[model samples]
Target: MVLPTLDKPVGQCLTNLRRPGGLGKDPERAQRRAEQLAAVDPDWNPGALGWTVDWQRHYTGLTLLLEGGAGLEEIVPGVTHRGDDIGRWLARQRRDWARLNTEQQHRLGEMGVKPVARPQKTATRTNTKTGATKGSDAFTRGVAALQQYIAREGTTVVSRSHVERLPDGTEHRTGVWAANQRARRDKLDAAQLSMLAALGLEWAA
Candidate 1:
């Protein structure tokens, strides 16, 4: 049985089949087909398992590595298989462990996966002369401004001329910054993009 990848037509077919008016329209046939697929691979429907197929694909790769006698320590970041970054996915799974459902956590536990420990935050030194905290980059400043804008306005729809002022008296051209970020999104890393998406930037997603 062929497993579905995120970009594959088979994956799209599976997604379509799970829609309300799709396979469920014919309960009997759907059950029969589901059973057939399950007989080959019980995890044929990862959505039902409370995760995305992209997640499942990377997980399957991890399991394959483990089955082939790879140690957990060997699965650090930068490890790749079939174009999927197994190590990065595993790290995310560990870092975002709280976001996983009970069953998902159980499944990962069965594979000896555990939550990663969060690093302790060090205190930042303030510029006493200027009365402002230092060391924030442009992107970091923009995200902070966007967050403040959302808190005040209840949305991320900033006008082209919108300006957001920070508590430290710094002004950020929020709208222009957002537009620039979206335009150069391809250069952003996954964590950076995820942060923007969490702040309600749909384009970042």
Candidate 2:
């Protein structure tokens, strides 16, 4: 906890942004929960601020991911400068809105953009060019896994779970993976079991 300052009243409660107690849970997880609820709620509007590709004349726009915030965000799809957002994503791409021809539409679609509407349950989170994401099979099968672990345990310097150890006593994850999820999963599974048999990947070893 940070120390109380002189300007702040003594004994008054202060909201800690770091811990998320007063700020509420992280928006990503909260959004996932809200969608899960909507799936079960009969009264929920099918158009109830769920994820959609907002076409504001198309040419100079970006995809918006409307999720949890002060209000519904999924209405936008991907975040773009012209659209409304609670705040910009921590990570972002730089685009030149001026470079785009707002009035015209491409017949064969641009490099990183898709024309079809996105669906919820299997909404693909990817990098259009590389098809990559935070935990893409190539990046880390372990991002959400690690984040979920963090949400439960809070802050700590050391961590456990799914850490792979190679020879030479170096403990770390090392490998590339197939582009397909099914193939990637099978590879990871086999690798992990083999590592276990070889006396690596053991939590206590």
Candidate 3:
């Protein structure tokens, strides 16, 4: 029998299978169906593995890349497989290691995944000569505007025509700024990409 693809409907079906009611309220058939799925892939039930299906899917992709002769270094951000960004997922797993449970940590550790050092926060400084803040480059100012917008709106979905006003009497066309950054994303350094990702930009991730 062919296994069903784990799309939304199938995913919901799997979730329902784990409930007390079982599939279609038929204990015997549900048991047989569950057994068949288990025979195909033991970790079919994500709850049993103590993680979400999305997490398991990304982990499987990472393992597949390794099995296909890709090294850890080659798994840096932008590596995509089966439409999932394995590199970004791996980076997030390492950067947020403390958020994972011991089981998840052990699984990742077995695959040579380790935590990354937290980036140091730079203190904002004022220019003595101009009386304005230093490091207010275009990118930096755009990121600051995006950060402020997120803090106020609780989302990164800025309208293309939205303008953000800063507390320092500066106004930023944040929506346009973000669009420009994404358009020339290839020129952005890793640090710039990380800042955009931190602001919840999906493309940067």
Candidates' TM-scores?
0.55, 0.19, 0.50
Each model's lDDT: 0.74, 0.30, 0.76
Tens digit of per-residue lDDT, candidate 3, span 62-157: 999999999999998799889888998888878767656698899989988899988786755545534433433777889878876664444567
Clash count per candidate = 0, 8, 0
Model with the higher lDDT, candidate 1 or 2 = 1
User: Pick by TM-score: which candidate is best?
Assistant: 1
* Residue 51, model 1: Cα distance from true site in angstroms: 0.5
- Give the alpha carbon lDDT tens digit for every residue of 1-205 in model 2: 3344645542232212223433356777756655664576532221122111121212222333222232322324344445432122211111112222332124113423333343455555445535534224533433223323233223212233335343345444322121132234444453333322111122211
Which sequence of candidate numbers ranks them by TM-score, best first?
A: 1, 3, 2
Compose the digit string of candidate 1's lDDT tens values, residues 32-103. 888887897888776566555556677889999999999988998798888777886787778767656798
Q: Identify the leading candidate in terms of lDDT.
A: 3
Off by over 4 Å in 1: 1-12, 119-205
